[model samples]
Target chain A: MSEFIKPTPMPRKYFTPTVIFLSVIALVGIIFVFARLIFGIGTVTNLSNQYPWGIWIGIDVAAGVALAAGGFTTAALGHIMHKEEYHLITRPALLTAMLGYTFVAMSVAIDLGRYYYIWHPLIMWNGTSVLFEVGICVMIYLTVLYIEFLPIVTERFIGRVNLPGLLKKYNNSVDKFLRALDRGLDKTMFIFIIAGVVLSCLHQSSLGTLMVIAGPKMHPLWQTPILPLLFLLSAISVGLPMVIFESVLTSRSFDLKPETPILAGLGRMIAPILFIYLSFKIGDMVIRQTFVYLTEFNTASVMFVIELVLGIIVPLRLFMSPQIQRSPLGLSIASFLVIFGVFLNRLNNFIVAYTPPYQFTPYFPSVGEIFVTAGFIAIEVLLFRAFVMIFPIVSVPQIPAVHKTKFSIRGAK
Target chain B: MANQSRRNFLKTSALIGAGLTGVSSKPAKAAPNNILDENRMGVLVDTTVCIGCRKCEWACKTAHNLSAQSIESYNDRSVFKNMRRPDDKTLTVVNEYAAKGDDQFPVDVKVQCMHCDKPACVSACIVGAFSKEKNGSVIWNGDRCIGCRYCMVACPFQVPAFEYGKAIQPEVRKCDFCFDRTKDGKLPACVEICPMEVLTYGRREELIDLAHQKISLYPDRYVNNVYGEHEVGGTSWLYLAGRDFHELQFPKLGTNPAPGVSEAIQHGIFAYFVPPIALYALFGGVMWLNKNRKQDEHKEANHE
Candidate 1:
């Protein structure tokens, strides 16, 4: 038993590289951000009123919400469906969501024209706008996520071992209180879980609606009234797979036990959702007769076909094979492909496919834009590492030992 | 393009169908086509008499205190390749037209806000940034503009442009039909500035008659149809052209108004406050049921 079940404390050393890399990237991004602010948007980004939104819209809002889709998916199966087998994977999905949203909030700060006046949208009233609804929903959802992560933060910052003199006394009560609070949180999660799912459904779709008003300026291949539905479905399709990919990577890096079977099961469930997405996506195209454009190889036409093939069909086919799902490297690659596909599809919608029919220049995200995007990702990671270290996020049994298991020793989560 | 258009038309109907499906059980009947109220005001532009000189564009810029275009002094020789549309800096532009079968081939169109009676920009705006005044002007207020640039996107003419350069003081700028001029009972800056007595501002009924009169007078030169007469549910500023209107970059669109289709759909779905209210109730009920189910499971486990 001793030979099979040796344990090691969380190492402080492995975190250095991640910290150093993020700091270097963030410093570079901060400089470019100032260039954008001081010299005006025209100086930095290729964005025109013709394409007022560029990479920020695509990467920050569209992809951000889609990445954040894991939380709702996890909540759906784990909490509402009452599946205890998947409980260990919930914290990882929640971590992904928290980071995804924090990045989004940062993106919003950088993207807004009158950055200060963003509060006006919140403070003022406009009942009819889908944007207003989305804004309110996302804000409420963000607040709920922090509350969701509250136990983790408390555990990290207020541990009995970490707490110094007087506060450390009656550590048993503190431990008891934390456990009870954690259980209470689990008990009361139905409302937030449901709200998160629905709000995600609304806002992800509403992001499509944001561009719907661009009458003739947008290319016909991208613009459709069913945009909201397409966006919502695509977000879910991308999100479920993302959770599996992220969970495995984090587990491996942290030297934790594998959550492969549960994650693979989740990946299998996403297959049908992807099918629905593919059906609607293709059905919309075929019905619109955009398939004819596949024969004609213009920039717009090629982009339209490429977006469909890479973002949809390829990822769908890759994930279907049970053989590939078992291979960690294969699963990771497939996950990366799906994520990239979703991100590219959004960039296509927000930038590539968007056009001012009256003939204006195109828009692309600048170097500064890229940095801001990276910084958000970094902040989320930093927060995640902090959360996992302090909280009971990884189930204790899942941590992998450096020595091979004599009797099936579990690995890191 | 023809086959694609037919497919698009089919998709448009499908969209209308999909929109209706999400709403109430009752099937949607077509609203009355005879619902147009023709008492609205308009402007009349005579393309034949108009010289290529851009007096109206200059006057509009000066009146609005907008940035003067360098293309004005340089002309189309160097900058037609770098052609610009109405933007935050330039509120209006006069594209030089040298029509065939003429010595100089000199004709110009002074383009600005069309001041649509049923404006798409107004409907597209979530906040009341753009509004249709009763006195026949589509006015804009900077205070309420979210800088979402929906107005820029919604304008079929590509008229509204954003102040993307100013991070703090950005606002959407366009010709507001020179609402300030109309309020003081004066002609719009463009109309007042026209050197050739080509552009006319008056009640829409009077303008339609004037357009017809010019088209009749120069049956050889002028096209019979008034450009803005039935475009996008009718605009206050009308146009009479020598060649086809679309040749001059005028977008060919439906007379039914763009906003009418989108708003009616949004309103029908959002009307009676059904969607959000129903969604909230359903969520609340599910949460309550879920809480009880978890408790029941807990009790069963304890008993075991």
Candidate 2:
């Protein structure tokens, strides 16, 4: 258990062609972001009063928040559900979530016309507004995510809290403080874990509620009173798949043997949750008779069918197969489908399904808008890699015990 | 390119479904506000009387201090070649629908903010940046606006246009029913400038009565429907048109208030704070269950 618990940072070269390429994209994106902030949203986005929200809200904030569900899902599974073996993936998930949310905050700033008043939702409470609820819940959940990550920061520095030169005297004191903080966090960490899961559920569904207010503006195919339920169900369903997807990708990137057995168990969890989600989706469509619109061959109908078939049904079938669940490629593919499905679903809800009354032209995101979104994703990938390289995210417990003995012998000498 | 195949697949899927027809019911209307302000102001636009002069467009810009061409230059019938909406640059636009057979003049409809009684924008604005004033105008405040633009999405009439051209300190521009002028015992800019007396400004209740009286008096001249009286829970601006309102680009909408469905669901789940508390308790129960199991596993390990 100690061997499994004591994670070590991965030893790898930081600068690769992929990293440099991603950095370039991220740099270009940052430039566009500055353009947006300085010249306003109109300059960077194709968004108008006719289509006030575009890909930034749909992809960046909505899809980003959903993809980051791995953190809370793993937290609940490992800490609150006593699935102790799942603990190995929790740290990486937490880091991903922390960075994902940080990106979300930055996206909100970039997306807002009045970026300076981003904090307005914090102080001016409109209890009736779904956006207000989403805002407050996300802010609190972000804080909770950081608090949940403090132990990881503590773990990295606790063992060797050494400082250079004159600050050496305070190193021991800092070490003592970290150790005390780590101990204190362990005792109360479950509270934050539970709070994190609850807060996530609130905002996940509240995001759906944000669209529900658009009412007539939202196409009938996507709009339903059960939208919040569907959003919550989809988020919960996609959680395990995101973890599996990230885990598989992480292993491949680092050239480690994927955690096939643990991930196989996680993969099994996806089908059942997805079944629940599909049932709600199909049932809601039937109940509302939204399926009638499916025959129209329009953009909304086409996208709706794609979201259902490619994103949900195909992934559901793949995940249900026991053999496919165990296979890394199959599991990864299935998980990617689910993630992609949720992303498409958000896009459908925010853009495709939304038809403002007076719009004469269909909205396509501007080049700046696409670049800014791509930049945020690139930034996420870069940060995740850097963090994993520096901190103890992925484990290296399989290292030979002979090195440990040699280290102790050297210390004695 | 891959998207084309996906669309084809969806088309096939759509065709595969048969005999599964079910009709969706209309969205349930939210409870109407019982305390109607009888003295609140409203405008009755008699579209049949409008001459398509576009003078209201000029007057709106001039009164709002927006750039406008000379008032006489507004007589350009060429501008009516395409339909236009009330946008940032133009507060009001007069659209020409070809008049019925043998009629000399085309149906000229003037479009602007409806200023709904139960304004969806007011309800949807997260920061309370919009409000339905006592004068029956749905007004926006730039100071409180965070530029989230949720209100623009929420407006059924889609009247609130943003100053999307501005880089800094952009505003949500809309018809405020001349809120300031109304407060000073003056008519709205467009209402005061109509040479044909196309706009009749008065109390909302009296306007409704007058609209009904006009519709009945000349049933041949009117469609017998007083628009904005019940559409989307009534708007400050009512319309009496000769042809069907839909022919003049009026959206076909239900009588229910626009914010009703969303608010019902949002407020329902969050009512009395029951669900959130219940969810927390459920998480707590799960945590407690896991704690016991963890303890049992620890005890078994200790025994070993």
Candidate 3:
């Protein structure tokens, strides 16, 4: 049997050519974001009154929320279902979710016209609005996510509270505080875990309901009464794939052995979830007789076809293969296709299908818009790297005492 | 008119039944003042009579405190070459459609907020920023608006336009049906300023009668249909067009209210918060059972 590995902070150089490139992109995006705030949204974006939503909403908010489903899905598997073996991946997924939601809130603030009054939804209630439901659930869910992540913070700092010179005297007290926090969080975390799952289900579906009111203005191919159900199903389906995708990428990046067994198990489960989602999606279309639009050869039809066949069908086929599940590259490719499919689905639903009448010009993201979106993504990656470096996120194999000196030398180098 | 009254009665009964069943007990909070008061005001536009003078357009701009050019510039008929929607700069616009098959004069359609009885903006605004007043005016409250622009996406007529140019406190601009003026017992700016007496302002019920009367009297002059009568569960603004409404850039819509399906789904998911609470309990129960089963297995393994 192989030796057990403990979760540990990755020991690696922080700055690389890729990091520098990402920082430059992130910096340009920050400049554009500032321009969007100081100048009007109109200044930095191609968004007109006709198209109030742009890529910030489609990619940053919708896709961001969908991709972050890894946290809850893994939590449900490891904690609720008592699948303790999957615990190795849960922390990274949690961090991803926490960061993803924080960015979602930031993106929302940037997108709002009167961004200062974003808190209005809290004090003033509109139970009837799907947006109200989405807003409230997201606000509550973000809090739950932060609460869920608190234990990780305490875990990292509990016995290692080494304050600097002047504050060194308070290190003992800080350590005591972290210990108490860790104990308290350990008992209360189940409540939060369950809440997170419920909240995710609510808002994920409500996001679909957001477009339902657009009615005839939306393309017939996407407009249906069962949109909320389809959204919830798709989100659930994407969750495991996202976890597998991130896990494989992280292992590859850090030159660690990919957790192929755990990931292969995850891959086995994905086919069924994806199949369920595909069945409902195609079922809805058939029942509504919307498949007729596929023959028309339009942007909406072409996008819908690609999003289904490439994003769902191709990955579903690949994941069903035992050889592919065991192969890291094959699993990564299949997982990526699912992630890309979901991302494209969100973009298509929010931007492509929405064709307002009397539209003088079609909306395409401007240079500034593209930069800001790319910048947000780069910042997420940078933060993820920084997080894993400081926190015990990834698990590494235990080393023997005889080899420890050599390992230490390599880590220092 | 008989059919209209019967539908109204059924609607009222349905609402009362829904309220009695505790499904939508708080109707005021459930929708934005969905009372449907009998005396609610409406405007009837006779497109056959309108000359496309653009007087109402200038008057609307002036009344809304938007800058308007001199009244003489209003005679520029060339502006009608392209269809224009009401935007932040103009709360109302007059668009000209070509006359159908040798008809002498083209039709002039005034584009503005239809102010539906079941207003989608009131139902879609995240912060309850919009309300349907007793005067049948669907108005937006800037103080409550975060300007998320969900209302813009929800409007069946595509009326709400955001002021994207404003960096701060950008307001959603739409026709409030001149709510402020009409509340003080004055006519809407467009209704008062029309030279051809094209726009008629009155109680919604009375206007429907008048619209029907005009349609029956001048069968050859006007289409039999009154746009917005039952479209999207009835709008406060009624239109009498020379031809089919779709030809004049009006979107064809079903009789069901725009927010009906969405609201139903929302309520179903969150009815008394039962489903969510039940889901929470179910998860908690499964977790408890799983934990117990795992402990039992561990104890058995220890014995072994």
Identify the leading candidate in terms of lDDT.
Answer: 3
- In model 2, the runs with Cα more than 4 Å from the true position are A164-166, A400-413, B1-36
Summarize candidate 3's per-residue lDDT along B193-250 as a digit string, tens digits: 8999999998999999999999899898888999989999999999998788988889
Interface RMSD of each: 5.8, 4.9, 1.5
Rank order (by TM-score, best first): 3, 2, 1
Q: Which one wins on DockQ?
A: 3
**Global lDDT of each candidate:** 0.68, 0.83, 0.87
Model 2: per-residue lDDT, tens digit, B1-304?
A: 3774575355334433311231111111111111247688899999999999888999899888999989889988998899999988888899999967885569999999998888888777776677676678878878778888888888889888888767677888888888888879899999999999999999999999999999889989899899999999999899999999998889988899888877887777676566777888998998798778777877998999
Candidate 1 wrongly placed segments (more than 4 Å): A1-11, A154-187, A396-413, B1-40, B67-82, B102-104, B260-273, B280-304
**Native contacts present in each candidate (fraction):** 0.24, 0.63, 0.78
Candidate 1 lDDT, A247-300, residue by residue in tens: 777778687666566667776776688789889988888788767757877887
The TM-score leader among the candidates is 3
Native-to-model Cα distance after best TM-score fit, residue A89 in candidate 2, in Å: 1.5
* Least accurate 10 contiguous residues by lDDT in model 1 chain A: A404-413
In candidate 3, position A96 carries an lDDT of 93
For model 3, residues A240-359, the per-residue Cα lDDT tens digits are 888888988899789988888889999999999999999999999999999999999889999999999999999999999999999988999999999999999999889999999879
